[model samples]
Target: MAVSQTADTEELMTCLRIQLYHPEPQNIFSSLPMDNRLKQEAEDPVRLGRAAEACPFVLNDTKVSRKQLALMAFRVPGSTEMRFHVQNLSRKGRLQVNGIELRHLVGAELPDKALIRFGRYEMLVLREPGDSETHFEVLFERRIVAPSQEMGEGEARTVPVMESEDVTLSWREPINEPSESDEYQNC
Candidate 1:
């Protein structure tokens, strides 16, 4: 029993960690319920795009068109190494890795901290849990998308800043007395 459990653990450790970032406000699917089959790579190569409902990670950005598939990721047949492939759906659609726009590159070996920008979305490719460098915190300034003073509605998106500070806020004095009338307290 222990040996089988260890094998399962090893298989999970070989999987790649993919993080999605976008210029638009997007929900982090870490808390979302993942398909058991997909988690085990039952589908082999997972399809990801606006139309891929079975995709473990789905992008819900406005800039992403729901016309065709955008990206594909899979593990090497018998190896633990993973590969990422991209498909340009639109004439103006593009994918960028680490700020380098890939025009002719169909597939490439995913490296640690590899930044992928597909359409208006940016994805961070990370190694599995074994890497110490993969553990870090990301801080976002604001939650909702605020109207930009310069741009029109829904034109601006908040960018998240990487912060090292563990303490988010400083301690404040505790309020002893209630702001409302004290008569209610006596009752």
Candidate 2:
């Protein structure tokens, strides 16, 4: 249908058309107008470069040290037991985080008290599990955006490994219980 070449077409209708139900999650990471834009190819098709902060990293309490934490961003007072895949670029080791990981915070409904935190000349997440968003001083250091592909060098392997309801934090394989081989031990 050759639509009208009229002077006016409703902007809301145009927006709805663009908002078709794509299987992929919506990009909630909107940046300021002045913020420059760049493109990167990561596990997700294409992403904003300069606006890396907009990628939507969330954190919970105790999952990180109170000291300098870089390459992390955002915090939330939350619940709903969740797991997150965080990009850690620090000295490798197991670390305790008291709340849900930030990776899973994507597309999450944020609380009124939730505030984003960035630290260590980069960015990290801060979380408070009980949704207690009182006047907590959410301090963090701003950092330059690191390319998603450029992983920092570390001797230890760090990734999300979840067991039990309480998420135990670790930088390397725990020396105590081996992750496997206990299968047949019960026999």
Candidate 3:
């Protein structure tokens, strides 16, 4: 009887983790900050926004609303597979998942791997299997674009250009003689 109860408890367990992901740091000595990572249970919904009292995962950006979005976990009917869904709660901020936009109060099923964008933030969501629990990782990234520099009078101005790594050129030989079909058409 106790074994069956334990199995039931384990089957209901779900774990979720969120971390700030940096694709490539300009400095090699820089390391990932521990304060940016968070862990929570999937049974309860996770709220993200600028308010610390209402949301456990708080974003300090002013552009984020009080409750920007919520992540909810659900189990597939007739199957043990677990999946996650995201809902946009903010009326001012737009939510995007895998390039698909969600309006206010709109929700959508999250893919196994997805790129989510809200305001100036981007998150990579990944679903992975765990021992005795369903595990999910949300890698968060803040998109920051560098501003153009202004030059004073009599100073030279230069713009930065990015070079492409994949550049291909194809060359074909031209035919001097006309084909039989061209001769027939002419006649």
lDDT of each: 0.39, 0.26, 0.54
- By TM-score, the candidates rank as 3, 1, 2
Instruction: Quote the positional error of residue 61 for candidate 2 in Å.
Output: 29
**Which candidate number has the best lDDT?**
3
- Comparison by lDDT, 1 against 3, better one: 3
Q: Write the per-residue lDDT of candidate 3 for residues 1-187, one digit (tens) a residue.
A: 3356555444433334343332344331122223343444657677887777887667666667999889887776776666677888899888765555677888876655455667645565555544333444444333333111112212211211112332221112221455455555653
Better of 1 and 3 by TM-score: 3
Q: Cα deviation in Å at residue 98, candidate 2?
A: 15
lDDT of 2 by residue, 28-64 (tens): 2223121232221122211112224432222222333
How far does residue 20 in candidate 2 sit from its true spot (Å)?
33
lDDT by residue (tens digit), candidate 1, 1-187: 3366555333333344444444444463333333222243323444454444544334444455443233444444775444444443444466554444444324444443345556645455444432112122121122132213223323223321112233121112221455777676855
In order of lDDT, best first, we have 3, 1, 2
lDDT of 2: 0.26
**RMSD for each of the candidates:** 18.9, 17.4, 15.2
TM-score of each: 0.45, 0.19, 0.55
Candidate 3: give the clashing pairs.
none
